[model samples]
Target chain A: MKKDIAKLLQRKKKQIIDLWMKNQLADASLREDLMSNEELLEQSDELVNALLSKLTDDNLSNAESTDFDDVYEILSGISISRARQGFSPRETGVYIFSLKDALQEIVQQELRNDPVTLYEVSIKISKLIDSFGVVTFETFIKGREEVILRQTDEIAEISTPVIRVWDGIVALPIIGTLDSARTQVVMESLLQEIVDTGSGIAILDISGVPAVDSLVAQHLIKTVSATRLMGAECIISGIRPEIAQTVVHLGIDLSNIVTKSTLASALKHAFTLLQLEVRRKQKETSTLKSNI
Target chain B: MGHFLLVTIQVDLYDRLALNLEADLVQMVSKTGARGVLIDISAVSIVDSFMGRIIGNIANMTKIMDAETVVVGMQPAVAITLIELGLPLTGVHTALNVEKGMELLRKKILVDGEADNSDDEDQPGDGAE
Candidate 1:
């Protein structure tokens, strides 16, 4: 009469924790690499205790009930941590669902004398645990998404590097497909380097670009024009043969841009523009050569 | 007219100021019989299509008056902005600094002086690209 399920679960917290831990350990997906046995015990014990304290017959069917806030918090914490620890979906799913199995096993034994009450309570608890499993999955995916977002940010930062290849020339070799945002970064950094180094020539080697569409061409043009605006000539080098075919096929006008077939040629052009010659130093024919 | 008119535009120019300068420059070139015009715009920061047109007009007008015109000391930012604005500055010659501008003008005058006794009519101007 006085919230019998919550009171019973609270009284037998130790029994539930033992059974839940046994169920997890006996399962084949138990990953000792991700979490140690002692850590798993502590986490399982804490979650089971929080859930039992918050459990009530009224809130059994409603996992989102305010009274279950502490339970939800503990559940989400475990879920996100497992996600970061590289647990598979099935491993994590088994973790939350196994707790339900242990609880149901205890519920069946505790309510064996009254089948009707047992059936209703079992249904309610099943729904509640199922919803908690869903919340676990949601938080797990959110955690994974955060990791992916961080990786994307790192890629964007590292992909656009402007290198000073010569005393008065800079080269930017793009290794990925160019989007508008990336193109903007390339242009800003190139222009900044031009101003800093007083470089008159900037070489953009886009041989790594996979395809040549109109949009990619437009971004390239914008970057080139931006470089030129700095009163520096921009030479686009490393135009692959297929990319050249696509450019002509698309009728994209790169007439104003100076394109080279390789980075070496672009460097040579930069040297010519800067009036720099890479001369080979003659070896001193030593009088000591006779001693040798 | 005596040697060459050196106009150093130190501030951002408006339409009226630019047009007035162009008109005065043409008249001065003819009145003084100057051989070249050097407009130092390294400090003038802003340029729109209208300003680009005015600069082009000055170059063309001076050329018609038998004087070569050179734009010198254009800042990187200004050049970038002008290029983005679709003005490639094809009509007039551009130099990195004042010294280069003077050398360009001197070479032009030398070519003209040797090629003809009197400077002939100007060729049609190439518009902003």
Candidate 2:
């Protein structure tokens, strides 16, 4: 009976030590001290909670411990190293920020750092950040364009590679290469503006576009579909001869969207199709009656 | 002052107006001692995420300025576009149209003003209406 009681106490001490280690508290020495003291064991839960709360509070306050200057110094060092290896500052900045965040997190966990694991993490971080950096740069460039386009409501003229005239009644004018992103932007802006302006006809002039790929052609078709849904018409204008040949070679059908040679011709056709002459006559008659 | 500021964007297209059109409108409302703002965007044809975020940021900043902000004129397509873009215009208030937005602003203003005025009134013994 005495031997059994002693074994039971030993097991309880082991159990408490295991729990403490799992909770990321003070290591073997502290765990041993905790297990030996009956009074400390009694207050184990309270002590654990207090330690965790303190750590969290310290983390929150210490987050801003690294000043902007420190960050900038680290960034500059990374940039110089990257330049030596033939990478841009924009790319280097991304790689460094990502690595810094991961390194900080790992250090915070107070884990024993394996050199091999550190190397792997650094390589992964570098590649991921580089890719992200390239994408970020591209997005920034696109953002500048968006700003320009968004501000350019007063543009009197635009040119593109291909223009489509819909129903011989509207001229659809497109400019620049039509990527999926730009296509969506253009489509929504054009359709809403067309509706708001109450234009009887629209001219989609695309004389300024340098090229049209398969994705772009599909985007054009989708734009046409969206426009029809909104009770407006779309016309593709400025179909360069080479682009026409490519369209045929690629077997991409432009059947749904109307096509035109030039914006001027499309506008003329649109006017005739809408029978705008009648409206003009009606306006004249109303004015004459009012005068009388 | 009430929490909401009401401003009408009379232009048919917001892009055609000044780049700081929304900011200017908010400034006007601030001058009027409004604690909140409601912007009428029904007349706008296109609303990009950048513009949406600006409105949201304005709302957040307005809080610091002792005001709140709301955005109205969210067409179905526009709303969907904004969502698809993953831009959150959370803090701003949105209404169906300008009139509705104005009504909300007016109600808030009246309630706040009445509360303040009653607090200042010394005639506690006056008969209830």
Candidate 3:
């Protein structure tokens, strides 16, 4: 009976070894599967199970400590190549996440050369995610607050900047800081508003501005140039004293543009330039004559 | 420095209210000397360009008064419509609620006061305000 028990134990050990080898083969196949089809990357559970089952006494003893950085380097190369092949941003995020997960598992299993190597892999993965253009309102804000915040920003930034007047007079009141990106957005929105409204006069009020940089000044000049091309008069208003000093010091020229110190002054100037005053007088005269 | 103006509009007379709000706001600012005015839109749901134009007018009027006017508490759908219609509120301040509007107005008042004080010191004979 003792001899029989010993033979059974030996058979069980051999079977376990064979099973481990089979699992290793399966893990290798799954890795190839993930690489070929991006969708398989989300199947993390199956991949993790396959990797765990592959460990055996002999293989574990012989396994060299893996460097997660090496794996990340390989993954980064593959991701860039895929991106060059026209992979979408979402696909790139998925692919990067998969590689990060695998590397994390290896580190957690204590198979990595240094535990700190995991942090390096994580940083690379984050950089890759940023490169994927992962900016959206939903990602930044949660629930109904997202909608409200976005609406508020839109109203403050886009809607409040451009005002449409009767007879094609568009006024934009600028406040706060004008970074490069925001400047671009403001330019595009104003141009589109002018086109849609067919405004003959575009007034930009910078009264609320505290300062102006070279880049912002450049954007303003560009906006004026474009508006002139469309046969529209661009009026700038609210030139604060400090901003004026900066513009002069920076050698930015505003020779061709019309400027005013206030929105009321700008509108009055715009009305005169657009020849709307004569029309207003004619209407008033007609009304007076009819009343008489 | 923060003042609230509640202008009630009957459902059918909303259009008239939009056309008249700017003139009314100008008169109010002249009377109150408040730094900010908040127009509550919690009662009205739909707003057209006429209303938007009036809001713009109020914004411009406030600048003349050396004050700021913010349209507050507009329904979400109305806000969306205003955006889609390309209604211009240039020079107009907007806020999600009355409290926020007050906060913005107070900040504007403080900043303007500081600027005026500095301008006074810079140009002694000239009236900066």
Candidate 4:
């Protein structure tokens, strides 16, 4: 009977797992800090059992076989979880390669008497592990992308904050680049706050925004018109010198909407609209000395 | 329904309701000789181009009859939709709520009353009261 590489590996599962664990632990890039040694061993144990259980003579060389679905699923799960746990690509790549090294070493030992069988099985193991390596890398990238997408949504939610500055006045400070989706969020929040507070004046502070282009100006105009339609006055504040130059150069008509150079001025304008005034008491120091 | 007509739109505006409102509002204006119209649209959450145009028509009709129209309590989404529909509702006064709408309508009437008094012979009549 021709020597079966799958049966040979299956019979020596414990040795293969032991060697694989030793190979991974000895690697210089091994990150014991990110993952505990016990956890690593548990993960390696599950992967070895999954891989060996599905290994057969016919499908030993074919990594794309349906028999390897459980193997791939387990491998992808490890790769993605490791990726989220901050494992580098080099570390993950070394992990798969070390398992291949252990399997080949055992195969070489088992077929030392027959060189031809050993060489053929070694090539098959190399091709199979290489495919697993590709899967690991792909899943790692997908995992990182999911994290980035979630953070982006969080930033959008926290960035637009509508603060009630005074009676009948609200202030919304927009931080970051203004996109169409973000504009919709900002408009909805600002308008809702206006209704809730019964604020007649709304000051939009854009100092946190890095730059202003025509598209941004258009969004600002739309927001202003919407606020006006709600019977509230909208003030665009924090117009830097550069933004002013760009606005004038683009010939964007902000003539009808009120624009202020600073938030302080905008608040002052809001106060004026609400017919409110702020005054300091005179000679408080003299009264304090007389009381003493 | 006094010197001023208060129309509180409590339901979603359909074609027939909007048209009837326009006609009834105009008729009421001429019959009562009302000097102002305060429309409280706080409950309205949706507005289309037809609704926007109907509002403009109401404003115009009231203006021809020498009455001021003040739209009040418009929701933010409804406002954005109206603006996107290219109907800014210009030449129509706006206020935050019904109370503010009444104040705005009274101011407009007072201003127009003063203007009319100035145009004719000076009379010691406070027409707003």
Candidate 5:
């Protein structure tokens, strides 16, 4: 009976493909923009061929059996590719289940003469197709998750950038709220740059930071101390007046940390520590001197 | 290595071991008549509040004995932990390496020596003048 169903499917492959595409086209959730009709038909042809090649009487009861690996593989490939291509879950669901609808119609027509065997074989085939449809959605969701995970990794990579503002000085201007995870990244990158460049000073400009609570203050202190341990001095600059008040209201001890109200003053203080002098020369142009 | 004592802390110290080392370090400074002490702690990984206080105490004790102390080769993680523990390592001199610490200690001693010589020379000269 399995061989009979497989042979019937093998002989009417083109008809099955046409019926499956027709079923999909009839569904309102079909995503033609994500997948063209021609491409959808091509995918339909491949999945159907794989499914028929693996179909057998014993394996028809279960789609997860090793015997159905190739069919399952093709189904998952189509589902995941549809997900990445921005096809809706309903469209992907219809894509797999519609093929089952097409094949079932043919199976019922083929086994018309034998009632008992037809009931058993048709039920097994339905169960097998249902399992494969489920596998498709599972892989579909997984593919979407993969996209999210990659985007998250990319965000983490772009967030932290340690720039050298001057020789023997690197500036890390933190633009967001200071959290432990980001703090670890900031600490590692800062420490590595200090070691690599042998910089004597690091300026953590928090002007871009929106707020400074106790936890943030602690992370900042930890970073400062870590830079100091690497034989470099860290200056917490760009402390707005509100943050200063917050530090005082919380009674956090920042006396040991060299903090400046602005990055300019912090850079100036770093110059003093490095024994650097940046003196401006007299302007040569008469027009510039007159403006001054 | 000379009149200056070099103490490199290679082992990860538990509670009592660190406390004992602090006392021993001060004793050694006075016994050896060392002018300077450089403690290399680059190998010590974990430092808690207790160890932080011990370090502070070591620096304070050695200061009383008229010997300068420079902590050298502190790991970044240890420093961060110490700061988070609320011990900012105040009144403690730190250097990146032993050579830098020695140079700092020598410069400190030289500056002290210069002050002493000027004080001695100026007192009599100023009194006579």
Candidate 6:
């Protein structure tokens, strides 16, 4: 009976592919913009071939059997690629279940004379396809997570940049929350830049930071201490008014570290530390104006 | 190497090595009458609480001997670890590199010398003046 079912599926391979394609195209959620019809047909053909070529009586009821490895591999590949291509989970799920529908249709037609066999074969096909659906979703989610993780790493790498604002001074503008991990990155990069530039002063601009809490305050203190240990003065700037209120309320002592309300003031202080001044060309501009 | 004792810690310090360093550093300070001690720790990557305490102790000892202590070229990770360990090496001075450390030590010694000279001249029994 099992051999008969496998043989029946083998004989109707082309019919199964056509029926699956028709079912997918007929579905309202078909994503034509993301995938061309020919590409869809080619993917469906490959998956159908893998499934039918491996179908046997012994492995028909057990979806976890090794015989279905090729099918699972192809399904996961298609689903994962679809996930990266921005196909919705529903669309990917429909793509697989439609093939199940096609196989069921063929089995039902071939077993019309025997109701008992028809019921048994349909149940087996349903279980196998349901398991495939689960694998596809799993791979799809995994692919999406991979994309998210890569984006996070890239953000962390590019967010903490040390900018040299003067001959002996560097500035680092932090744009995110000051977590311990981010604080480590900020400290390492800032200290390394200070050494590279031989900057005696470092300005930490936190204008882009949204909030300041106790934990964040602790991380900031650690960074400042690390900078001081490197023999460079660390000036924290761009403290919002609310952040000031929060810091005071929390009773966190920032008295030892120089804190400025703006980057401009921080730069001015840094200039004074280096004994370097930025004066306007007042006399030259006045002479030119008088001549004109 | 001149008026200053330069110690470069090139390996991870254990308890015994750190203790030995503290004792030897004090002895050398008294023996050479060095005005400054510069500890270069750029090569030392790992540190523990015991090492941190030893560094603090060395700074304190050197300060008592009328010698300035400057820790130079401290790695960022090591600095953070030391800070988290609750040992800021408070009595110690710090510089970015060996050259800067030397400059700091020289300036400190020169200022102390000038202060001493001024104090001696202020006294009534100063024959050289």
TM-score of chain B, candidates 1 onward in order = 0.85, 0.64, 0.77, 0.87, 0.85, 0.84
Candidate 4: tens digits of C-alpha lDDT, residues A162-195: 9999988899999999988899889999999998
Q: Report the poorest 10 consecutive residues by lDDT, candidate 1 chain B.
A: B120-129
Which candidate would rank higher by DockQ, 1 or 3?
Answer: 1
Residue ranges of candidate 5 with Cα displaced over 4 Å:
A1-14, A25-42, A56-68, A83-91, A107-135, A210-218, A240-256, A272-292, B1-32, B39-69, B74-93, B98-100, B103-129
Output the worst ten-in-a-row residue range by lDDT, candidate 5 chain A.
Answer: A279-288
What tens-digit string does per-residue lDDT give for candidate 5 at B50-111?
A: 77778888888999888888888877666666665677688888877787787778767766
Task: Put down candidate 6 lDDT per residue, A87-146, tens digits, no spaces.
Answer: 999999999998889999999899999999899999999999999999999999998998
Residues A180-200, candidate 3: write the lDDT tens digits.
556556666676676566566
lDDT digits (tens) for residues B15-91 of candidate 4: 99899999999999999898888899989888777888899999999999899898999988888778777788888
Candidate 1, residue B71: Cα displacement in angstroms equals 10
What lDDT does each candidate get?
0.82, 0.52, 0.56, 0.88, 0.81, 0.88
Encode model 5's per-residue lDDT on A140-175: one tens digit a residue. Answer: 999999999888667656777888999989998888
Error of 4 at A271 (Å): 2.8
TM-score of chain A of each: 0.85, 0.43, 0.47, 0.84, 0.75, 0.87
B7-82 in candidate 6: lDDT tens per residue? 9999998788889999999999999888789999999887677777788889898998999899998887788878
lDDT of 3 by residue, B25-89 (tens): 68887887766677767566677777767667777877887777777655544543454355535
Q: Which stretches of candidate 6 lie over 4 Å from their true place?
A: A277-292, B13-18, B81-90, B106-129
Per-residue error (Å), model 6, residue A128? 2.5
lDDT of 1 by residue, A176-211 (tens): 889877776777778777767767789999988898
Error of 1 at A71 (Å): 3.5
For residue B2, give model 1's deviation from the true position in Å: 10
By DockQ: ranked, best first: 4, 6, 5, 1, 2, 3
RMSD of each: 7.6, 25.2, 21.3, 4.9, 7.0, 5.0
The residue pairs that clash in candidate 3, if any, are none
- Clash count list over all predictions: 3, 39, 0, 0, 0, 0
